[model samples]
Target chain A: MIGLYLTAPYLVYLVIVYAVPIIQGFRISVLDYVYAAPGASVPQPFVGLKNYRKALSDPLLRRSFLNILEFLAINVPLTVILGMTLAAVLAKLSRMKTFFRSAFFVPYVTASIAVIGVWYFLFSQGGLIDHVLGSWAPNPSWLVNSKLAMVVIALEVTWKQLGFYVLLYLAGVLLIPDSLYEAASIDGAGPVRQFRAITVPALRNITILVTTLALIVGANLFAEPYLLTGGGGPNGATMSPALLIYQKGVEQGEPGVGAAIGVLLTLFILLVAGAGAGARRLVQAREAA
Target chain B: MRNGQYGRTLRRLTTYGFVTLGALASIFPLYYMVVGSLQLRADSAFSGLIPKAGNLGLQNYRDVNKAISLLPSLGNSAIFTLGTVVLTIVVGLPAGYALARLRFPGKPAVAGGLILVLVLPFQVMMIPLYILAVRDYGLADNYLGMILPFAVNPAAVLIFRQFFISLPDELFDAAHIDGAGEVRTLLLVAAPLTKPAILTASVITFIGPWNEFLWPFLITKKHSMQPLAVSLGEYVSTNAATAANPYGVILAGACVLAVPVIALFLVAQRYFTSAALGSGVKE
Candidate 1:
């Protein structure tokens, strides 16, 4: 009793700070509410799945979902490949390993606003990229063009995240015993062949881990496109589900709809995360067996 | 054998070249940001990798300061980030210790729940949490509003727990024989051994709060309450015209925001590298 009392402040803090918001969030999803008309009335008629249906059927919402799917499809593989290659190379360096690692990871630590700012300049018309390209051809506004806008945003996310993936891959690669490489070398297996046969296979689990985590995060894309294209510019070309919820809830003052989108997004993320965890466990189990 | 050695040297050279090139590509934008930030507004059009002498000036910093309260926003960020780090470490350490060391009931359930929390995306809860913060808690537009939601990151807890679990049981047995209670044991004996994990957790939590944009942007509307990220966003948005978009000032802000974490990581670079690698491996 004394121990519980002593720790009561911490427990209360967690319950109030962490748990209540989640519970309240769910409750608000069921209740039809608007932020604009505060203190309008209580018992604000529960509108069971109406908000969810609206969120699901809305064309803007559907487009946002499609945009996220497109982002995942394009960015995931590129990040994984780039990260693995960099990690593999870095792992071999006998000197300057720390410098290279820090350099790569620097972008990950920098503010997203700063990253977007730099990228905006790079991708803008008559900016760095355009300046380089204009010597050969006419320049187009990267952010204005819908297709190009998506690509630019994807590139920004990849830049920020690739370092993290490199770190993960380095960890995965370092775990493989050097004896395997030595044995492969003794067998006259060249570097490329050894990497393909041993390194790739050994890194299978980490690859899956990275891919699944990236997929989950990629689907929640918000800040890059939001900053780049000004929150789904030029006919909502790059809007994600997360941004859609923000728009509905904050911008449009429709809390219920926003909450509904939040619930759906949560469900989608959970489903993917659960599948990934299960798959990882199965792989581990099989390997152990 | 000579041909084989030549081929091996060629492969090594290619690997080194590729790695260097990749690092350069990764670091270039950041380099551009820094170089551009030092340039005068008129010279913002310079497309080169380096900033020239005349163009390199502190005018952008002056303009940024005059235009936006960059310092205050930085202070707000520090306050929020520091608060988050302290709260997370304090709350997380004990819970993590208990879950790791104690033969408590429902141990697996607690551990599993923490892992699930780690993988769960905060985007899903953003709207609902915002409403709750505003309505129920009255935390909207307040410092606590931003700090509280992030006070207990499950990832930090999990990492701490994992580190604690790896400690030898003999330490706890010795502490018990010395008549030290669990709390004392954690604070005195266990914690000293878990510094690496604690530092790693602190670094991660600090970075998350420091660079966080969406939550702060959503929760806080007042300019004074905004962090550096939110302020920078507003600065770019509002001053898109008449300001020449001082890349130098923006980069200065970026550097200001980035330097502390970068330095912390550099100081603890070994721990960070190990933690980054270690966390990916299975228990």
Candidate 2:
């Protein structure tokens, strides 16, 4: 009875709030749901996988997936490499480490909307970027230019997220024993050689972990693009899968299509996450052998 | 020896130089935001790295206030964030404890499922959740609509569960001998012991609700109901064509929104880093 009392509130909250909605969400996906036609009898017709078929067939959906793929391709590697490099420096720093660490990490803690606000100013016409460009070339309208818009958004994500990756990498680097570096140094290995042999190998798991997280976060890109490009503007140049899902589902009132896209995106994330876990296990086994 | 010393100096200089450049690249956008916010409309046209000190006035700040009810929006954000944090912790703590300590059936499956949920995009589940909220539950444009869906954070529960599992079993046994029930023991014992984990979870929970854009934007259309992020986003989007971008006022707003989390981080920097990184590890 006591145990039941202890667990009841939490159990009830989770079931009612978290689990039920998630399960109900699946059910709603099957129905021809319309938020506006709320009182209509049998509002959502049970159309099994029809939404999924429409979503899969949509060119916008395919394009958004491709856009997310391109974004991940650039962002994942840049953030990881930059983060690892900064972490390496931070690990070696003997003075002002905390200050430097905090400075880099301020962005991660700041609101994403705020960060996007700052970027909007910098990337907009006659803003910082344009100001610089006016010195040499004609000012390009970044928010409207389809090709440049994606790159600008990508850069913004990298800048905001690099600090987080740095912290993660720093934790991994700190775990490497100093004696390993000493041993390499005594063996006539230079700093580069030490890092190549010791730091890289030791940080393998951290790399995989950070990369997977970056990919997941990157795939779910919404606020930045939504705010930055005005909901994937310039003919949908920077539209992510998440934004596409929101636009189709909420704005267009197509819950079925939205759920279908959502499932597809979830599957994509799951495959990446699974591959990462598998890779970590493989690395650990190889190291043990 | 002298040559080697010179080489070491050169290497140190190179390292410092590279790190400094990266740091500047990381922080330069923020610097621009600050400078741009301060400049007058005419000065803003120049877009130089440095702001003309005279052009730095309260005009932007005044404009931002006139344009949006930033203060009220911030209040709404705080209420929502605080409410969400309390709800998550109140519910998450016991559930985490149950999963960690109790020999419940489907424990491993529950644990694994929670982890899977963490990686699943909120976008996918959003439509169904929204339909349930508006159509079935009739929570449209209401605070409950926003709060209920977000209350049970999977990540918080996972972190709390991890922390709970590592706790010494003796504490529970001792409390049990004293005739303290599981609820009493959890409230008095486990909850206090997991301070760092709790604080970390609270900070993250606060940040998510405070910084959340899409959900609030989707759910609430009323200016009174909107939080700081959505309100500010709407303000910027609508006011983009104005001569001066009102950078300072926006920065001020951003700064206001940031202050609590920044302060929390500063107070618990070391523990915050450890807890964040520790919970992130797979094992």
Candidate 3:
């Protein structure tokens, strides 16, 4: 009775805010629900699987998903690798550890739009990157070019989020007993060998955690493209599925398509999370064996 | 011994080298933003990687404030973030304590549901929430709509639950012996013991709403009602009037949005690192 009493408020909140919205979202996605405009009457007919089918078939939606995939391919690996490397380096430091950790984390803590502002100037025409590159580079328009814009967004995101994953990785690194490293050193193992043998194996769980997190963050690539490239940029090059959902749902008045896109994005995130969890179980089982 | 000294020196050099370089890369953008904000000239947008003494001023900040409603937006951010922190602590603590201490029948299921909430993205639930807040409740332009959805955070609950579970049972038993009710025992004992947990949860909770753009942006369509994040997003992307001092104004806007959080982080730096390092990531 006490447990139920204590948990009731949170349960109520979850039901209203989270559970209800998700169910409503599923319902909206299957209907032809254009948002009702101010002082206008509109009919929202139940369209069954039409929105999902449209999302699957629509070229822009497909392209948006593809764009996010490309982004994930670059972002997830880069964030995890850079975060892992930096964490390993920071973990070894005996002096000024807090300084470097705090410095890296500043970007992570800052609002995305704020940092996006900083990055926009950095990569725009006659900006720092262009000023450095000079006229030797042909039209060094980072945000203008489709491929390069995606790369820049990835770099910005990786830079911002790297510190967070670093903290997580650092936690994983600290969990490994020092005695193992001492034993490895006594056996004539070098730093690289010790890192590979001890640090990597010990970080199996954390690696999964970081990758899963990075995948989720990468998939929800909205504000960067929205702020930097003006919501999809030149010819919808950097249009992430999240941005697409917003554009179609809110801005363009097609909430059904937006909800359909949301449903798909959730499934993709769940798939990645499931795989990460499964992989962790497999690794742990193997370790036990 | 000589070889060991050499190896140690090399290791130290590599460590400092990588760490310093990474830190510099991390801080360079922020440095540039501040410097660019100070230097108002359009031509010399980035006045060298090293900022000149003469090229700095406070006018652009004033201009940004004039151009957009920076102070009001920041005020909105503060209210929203503070409300979230308060609500998270108020609602999460009891639930977390229950999960930790009480003999709940559906404890395992509740715990699983909390973890599921952590994994689920906000984007997944955006559409329905937007409609509900706007259509059913007519809370589109209100702070309550923005604060309510995120008030009961699963992560805060999980953090508090972990902290409460690790507390000595004797304290609670002693409270019971003194005939203190559950509420009083929780208020007097468990609550006070959770300072570190509170700080951790507060910081974590603060960062989300403080930096959140999408939901606030969606709900509060009116510019005056928007938070700093949404306001900055609008100013940078769409505001045409600020194009006169584009770099300076935009950077100034960025600075306003970032400075508060950055200042808070700097002041409470010790709490952050220790909290993250020591207690987190057991799961």
Candidate 4:
């Protein structure tokens, strides 16, 4: 009972913040939450999945979803591989370990919104990156190139976030006992062999954790695309679901449709998380077998 | 032995070389943002990569300060971000302690509910939250509205719970013997020892709203109340033509906004890394 008393504040907050809004989110999804003029009462009539049906057929919405798919197709593998590789190498270092760790982490620690402007400046016409690429630079530039725009967004996301996953993997890598590696070397195993046989197997749970984190991040991406692409520019080539939600719900004054997108995005995230958990279990069970 | 020594030297050099390259890539944009902020407008594109020392000036910084009401917007971000950090810790600490230390019914239900909530994205709840606060409460144009939804942070709650659980049971038992209740025990015994959790929670929570664009942008359209990130965002997207050098002016504001966050990280980074390890939560 004392525990209940102590936890009362959170319970109340949970209802007001999470539970009520979540329920209201579902409610708004099914109703036409037409924007009313101030001090005017508007009755929201039930639309019965009209918003969802519209969402299914909406090309821009469809484009947004496809954009994110292409985004993760580039982002996920790059983040995981680079993160693991950096962590593995850093774990073996004795000199300037602190310096390397802090230096790598600075970008992740800095706000993406703050540094995204720098990416814009760099990638703009005849900017640092364009100047560096010389004649090989895309004619309209990378940020504006419909073909290469999403790739730039993904790479920007990777550059800003690689440190975070590196730190996570580094933590996991450190927990593998030095004895395992020493034993591997006694059998004349090289560093690559030791890493594969010893480090990889020991860090399975963290790897799963890292992959799920990367996936969740991929699913919810907003700030970079919003800023870097200047609000999904050059024909919505860089649009993300979060930006779409903002446009429909807040900007476009169609809360019902926005809520529908929100509902779909949430469902997608839940499904991905569930699938990730299942994969981890399957891997664990296989090891047990 | 000489061959072995040479091979080991080569391997170590390879490791250092790889890490340094990654670190340089990581840090360059920030360095460029600050350096570029100082470069004269005419110097851009012509001298983009290696900044000339003599040509750099504080003109862009001054221009940005004037361009977006940088000082006032900075104050708004400070208030908004600080308000969020304080409320998150205050509300999260007690709930986390109760979950970890106190015996209660429905504990499993609460835990599971927390997990369900964890998987939830803020984008999912953002609509109704906007409705609830902006429509129902009429808190549009208010910092409190911008701060509230994020205040009851699930990550902070989880971080605190995980931190409290790791504390030995003996501390709580002694507090109990001294006639301290659960809340009192947390206040006197646990809060002091949980600096790491507090710092980690503050770091993550502070970054989200301090740097968030959408919520504050939705809540308050008033220039005085808009956070620096939103103002800078508007500048980035729409208002670039107002400045002499749009690139430098925009980056100047970004640099100002980033200074405090990066400074805090530099000062307390060990707490950040160790705390993330301890809590299993991300910013």
Q: Work out the TM-score per prediction.
A: 0.92, 0.90, 0.94, 0.94
Model 1 lDDT per residue over B1-283, tens place:
9997998899889988988898898888878877777767534354456667766777777777777777898899999999999888887877777777776555565556566556666777787678777776778778888997788766677777788778888988999999998778877998788878877888877778888888998889888899888888777666655666555566666666666777776776676664544552343
Q: How much lDDT does each candidate structure score?
A: 0.76, 0.76, 0.82, 0.81
Candidate order by TM-score, highest to lowest? 4, 3, 1, 2
How large an RMSD does model 1 have? 3.2
Candidate 4 global lDDT: 0.81
B226: Cα error in model 1, Å: 1.1
Pick the winner on TM-score between candidates 2 and 4. 4
Residue range A1-289, candidate 4, lDDT tens digits: 8878767787887787788889999999999888776679989999998999987777777788788678778887787778888999998898888888888888876776777888888888878887777899898888888888888888988888788788888888888888988998999999999888887777666666666666666656777777787777768888888888888888888999999999998777667668778987898799899
Model 1 ranges with Cα > 4 A deviation: A1-14, A36-43, A135-139, A270-289, B42-47, B246-249, B276-283
What range of 10 consecutive residues in model 4 chain B has the weakest lDDT sum?
B274-283
TM-score of chain A of each: 0.86, 0.88, 0.90, 0.92
- Interface DockQ of each model: 0.50, 0.53, 0.65, 0.66
Position A277, candidate 3: lDDT = 81
What would the DockQ be for model 2?
0.53
RMSD of each: 3.2, 3.1, 2.5, 2.3
lDDT of 4 at A232: 79
- Highest lDDT, which number? 3
Tens-digit per-residue lDDT, B1-283, candidate 2: 9998998999888888778787777667666666656666534455356677667776776777677766888788888788889988887877788878886555665666567566666776777777777777777777777777678677788788888888999989999999997778888988788888888788767768888888887888899988888888877667745635556667656656666676776776776574465574454
Docking class for candidate 3: medium
Give the winner by DockQ. 4
lDDT of 1 at B278: 50
